[model samples]
Target: MRPIGIVSILREQTPAPDRSFNFLMAAAGNNTGNLLFTHAVWEHLPGPKERIGFQFDPDKVNATCRAVVFPAANWFGAHVDLADFADRVERLDVPVTMIGLGAQDHDFTGKVDVPEGTLRFVRAVAERSRSISVRGTYTRDILARHGFRDVTVTGCPSLYQPLQPDAERRLLENAKSTLGPTLLHSTRFSARYRAFVDTPSIHLDLYRYAYRTRSDLLFQSELEEISLLVEAAKKPDIDDALIATLLDLYGAASWEELQAYLHNSARVFFDIPAWTQAMTGYGRAYGTRLHATIMALNSGVPALLVHHDSRTREVCEFADLPSLKASRAALDEDAISKSITRADFGKFLKTRGRNQETYRAFLADNGLL
Candidate 1:
């Protein structure tokens, strides 16, 4: 059987022994959360597969694989430049499928200034694919505005990573069980956009919650956090200046306390299985990171998304995942417990089962299953 070609950064589940921070960042595509979805697309696909990276030889892929699949991120935004990717996809002779493509913006009502390059890229994918699977209706609508009609709302592939008939039942059971030590998934604030974005306050609130409860906090894309993890793992001491910077950024009580927390409660993972295993120990997970929340769900742990942007909001709604707007979510144990209690797991399970069928159909139509 011909192998499927997948676009990804990490070639294997485990990192090399000599893996540097830069290599880990590359594997994660600069965000550790990326491993969740990319691995899902890689693992969920049927048959043998080869990693073809972003810049692949199209002729080689056509000769060697049945199809080339791109597990995408929030590409429909002004911040990304997709011309180079578009150029490569335009040369492919085999079928192409992009899964979980999303549009990023401040809120659902905000319009994205789609780049011409990204538009070209979408056009190229649309031409090559039977249909493109988007994360939610917002992304489908965005592409619809661009004149593409073969878009499907399949949410993220990570939601179905469990690959079990009883996955929904397990998740529902976890949601109803007694709450345990919560895992917090949050993004560190960017100082450059601190004034314009609400992420800063949200991060602070999450950080405070994690600190007060002494619950585990997971870091995704922040370079400083990654650096701290590396330094803590390798050396006797982390840089004092770096610790100070993080203290200010996360509004930590003190440098020593924060450093202790980094060594104790903070976590980052390169291996998806290891991360999934870790999540199973947690009773509940919550915060602003979408993929992280999905990871918990995939592990049969209940999670609540604190949607601060369109990318997170639309996907949560599409997947029937319980969520609260960042503006409305109070970072307290009582509030979080209340939100989780109020969640309609029955509805979520029904929607998720239907979405799973939709995803399977999408894969089958694209010749991936």
Candidate 2:
């Protein structure tokens, strides 16, 4: 029987000693958060499979594989460059399926300027599949506008990563437990988008809370944080300007204090299992990174998402995850405590089960099951 071909790096192929930041970024598709869903998709698909790169040959793939699967990210946006990927997909002859594809925008206004290449990519996949799995209603709506109605809102494959049958009950129990020192999945400030204007304040407040409580800080794609980790590991000459900028941004008291936090409290993981295992130590997790929060939940740690854009917000709403918008979130000690306490775990469990069934049906329809 022919195996399916997955468009992802299932695990860290690069050895630890030789893994530079560029290699890590490439393995993660430029963001460490991508590992969550991509790994989930890889896990859920049954039978034999081969990991294929985007530069694959159509003739070889059609001859060797039954189908090809894409565990996609926020591909529907003006900023994404998918011209080469679209061309590759267009040439593929085997059945194609995409899971957890999403549209990125500042808000859920349904006004996204998708590039022509991305549109072509969507069409090519749609042509070869029974249905396309999307992250939320926003993504479904975006595809609907392009005249593709066969879309399913599966939230994200990452939500289905945990193997325990009683995972939802455990997650609920964990959420109700007394709060402890939290893990902050931090995001840095960016001026490239309008939604990022509120990022600094949200991140600063989270950083201050983490500092006061002695909680660890987790970084995903931020270059400055990665640089600090690289410096610590390699013993390189420190970038003083980068440290100063981060110190100011995060409201650290001094360079020494910031250094202490970086050395002791900051963490970046290149491996998915290690990252999920680390989340188990934290009583709670909250931040702007969606997959980081999902990782915590997968570890039976309660998590709250502070969503800044439609890409994050739509999934939170669809999955029934505990969330507060960055614009409306009050990050004070009392507010944060209340937000975590007020999350409706019962409702979340109910919605999660329904979404899981939908996801399984999607896979079955696409002949992946």
Instruction: Superpose all Cα atoms of candidate 2 onto the true structure and report the RMSD in Å to 1 decimal.
Output: 2.9
Q: In model 2, which regions exceed 4 Å deviation? A: 13-15, 163-166, 189-200, 230-238
Cα RMSDs, all models? 2.9, 2.9
lDDT of 2 by residue, 36-130 (tens): 88888988999998898777787889889999998898888888868887888888888999998999998678899988888888899999999
Q: How many angstroms is residue 336 displaced in model 2 relative to the true structure, after the best TM-score fit?
A: 1.8
lDDT of each: 0.80, 0.79
Report, for all candidates in order, the number of backbone clashes. 0, 0
User: What's model 1's overall lDDT?
Assistant: 0.80
Q: What would you estimate as the lDDT of candidate 2? A: 0.79
Clash pairs of candidate 2? none
Candidate 2, residue 329: the lDDT equals 78
